[model samples]
Target: MEVNNRYITITNHIQGSAKESDFELKVVPLRLSVEPGSSAVILKNLWVSIDPYQLNRMKRYSSSHKTVQPAVRITPGQPIDSPGVARVLVSDDPEFVKDDLVEGFVHWGEYTVVKGGMLRKLDPEIDLPLSYHAGVLGMSGLTAYAGLFEICKAKKGDKVFVSAACGSVGNLVGQYAKLSGCYVVGCAGSRDKVALLKEKLGFDDAFNYKEETDLNSALARYFPDGIDIYFDNVGGEMLEAAVANMNTCGRVAACGAIAEYSEGAKRAAPNMVDVIYKRIKIQGFLAIDHMSLHSDFLSTTTDYIHNGKIKVQEDISSGVESIPSAFIGLFRGDNIGKKIVKIADE
Candidate 1:
């Protein structure tokens, strides 16, 4: 049988903010049958993650060019791929079968053709919303788990701070710290998000970074004892400020720097002296490097969600057409928790 493909693709090279014009809805005529030398599977996509990390991919900008350098580049004519959730329609491999729900580097399409090591069957007993498997239970979940616990190596009663606290990965990081008995505080871009953090997400304290004229002062006020662990999501000034506020022997997990994603050049934020004075240890990690520990992440996060130790919020946008609006909204701090666009439901 043949498959049909209809998904979002980049219309052209982008200079600034991504517009709907930057993406075109295209249909690819798919042939489901794999060639004898090939092992490919057919996937009917359900939900897709609109992550900040994706913005880095849109640019014609590269090290050779003048705009944002590509940590991961997406060409102007290809489908936008991210960690997404899908149900298998057909497979030529022994590892997958029809009707298996999975997650991986799937394209922004109703149907996708992918090879091995890129799709995973989601656990059915999790009682999770389908989109949760794409965000919290998928990439975002592993990100927070690896960034906080694995790299940071947090301990009980430690003071932990998370930047961009209301988004997908930040929300989970704060919740995990709280569950692990850490004094968790988060700084967000707005007062509404601050309220959501403290009230809905149960952070120990939350501050609006936009309202704070001096980030250094805000950190001093919130972490009166100084931060012992910092889970960094938005770098630049926030990272510099967090460093200055670290207590002796503090740990910092350098995750994604969404603030610098669209910008060119590596500009160092002020305050490197703290690293020397406080004997701080900061480490940068790619979640891909920690894929070996995914089962452990799922196990721990699953138990927490099941037992109510953690709460996950998903900002769901229905239909594939909503991808551009949802993706653009992320830059404006429009999403509360994880932002996922539901393409279809099975």
Candidate 2:
């Protein structure tokens, strides 16, 4: 007789606004054992992170470029997934053994069987919350570090701009820029978040995008001389305005396009004309592109946290069933910081 497993699956390719009903909760019988020759691991999920990038996997890849992990397809009635942290219950490889804590390509279920390269060991003595590894010290932190430091190449006294400034990456980016001696400004969707950016995140200036009718003018007011470096997240009209306001030889790190994730529309039609006029350099980057820097990022961020030079905020929702509501909130700017869902607290 096989064991029964519980998991969450997608019901359809949500075209418009996503609703909770699109997810299907199921329980089925399966063998949970991993043998020595299997070259796989059996893990019990501890936490799961819901990020904006997952929206890309949900839709059709319009481009000819092969999707990352082209072999893994997200289809109807399949288990919904993302990077997650879990504990190894069984292992077949020499690198891991039973009861080892790990994190990687864990899905929406309670348990997963994945290969070695798909998982990594977690530090047990850190004394910080383990759920934090699913975020601040995890992929989100790496995204913030690689996107801001590596791509932007921010210098001291330079003017830096961050869109979605109060987000997980944005908040950290602003702080890092400040530490790097840059004059930083951030834009957020709400008034409260703007205030938090200034008061808590230590940004030099901040404003509410919802209150501004003309982003171009708004940017002009904050960056009177033009922006030297822009850490872009929301890519629609914001990119257009920022591009229009860049100084000579300005640099932009295109971190993400969350504004288009839900709407799936491109508003800022590549203003390369602006790039030529201002001699600006804007580049799109993925954290996976700089995987070699992950270890350096983790070590630096750990030191920053320990020395009290940096801080991270998170908005966590408990339970696997909360994935839909948590993910749906991102489109509405309903989350304050890093939005994560806890599959199992233990």
lDDT of each candidate versus the true structure: 0.84, 0.81
List, residue by residue over 25-108, the lDDT tens digit for candidate 2.
777775777765878887778888877776666655523125466224477777666778888877787888888887677877
Regions of model 2 farther than 4 Å from truth: 1-3, 62-65, 70-73
Give each model a TM-score.
Answer: 0.93, 0.94
Screening candidate 2 with a backbone cut-off below 3 angstroms (N, C-alpha, C), the clashing residue pairs are: none
Give per-residue CA lDDT, model 1, range 103-215, as digits (tens): 88788878888876477778788787778889889989998999888899977999999998999999999999998999999988888999999988899999988888899
Looking at candidate 2, the ten consecutive residues that score lowest on lDDT are 62-71
Residue 194 C-alpha lDDT in model 2: 90
Relative to the true structure, candidate 1 reaches a TM of 0.93
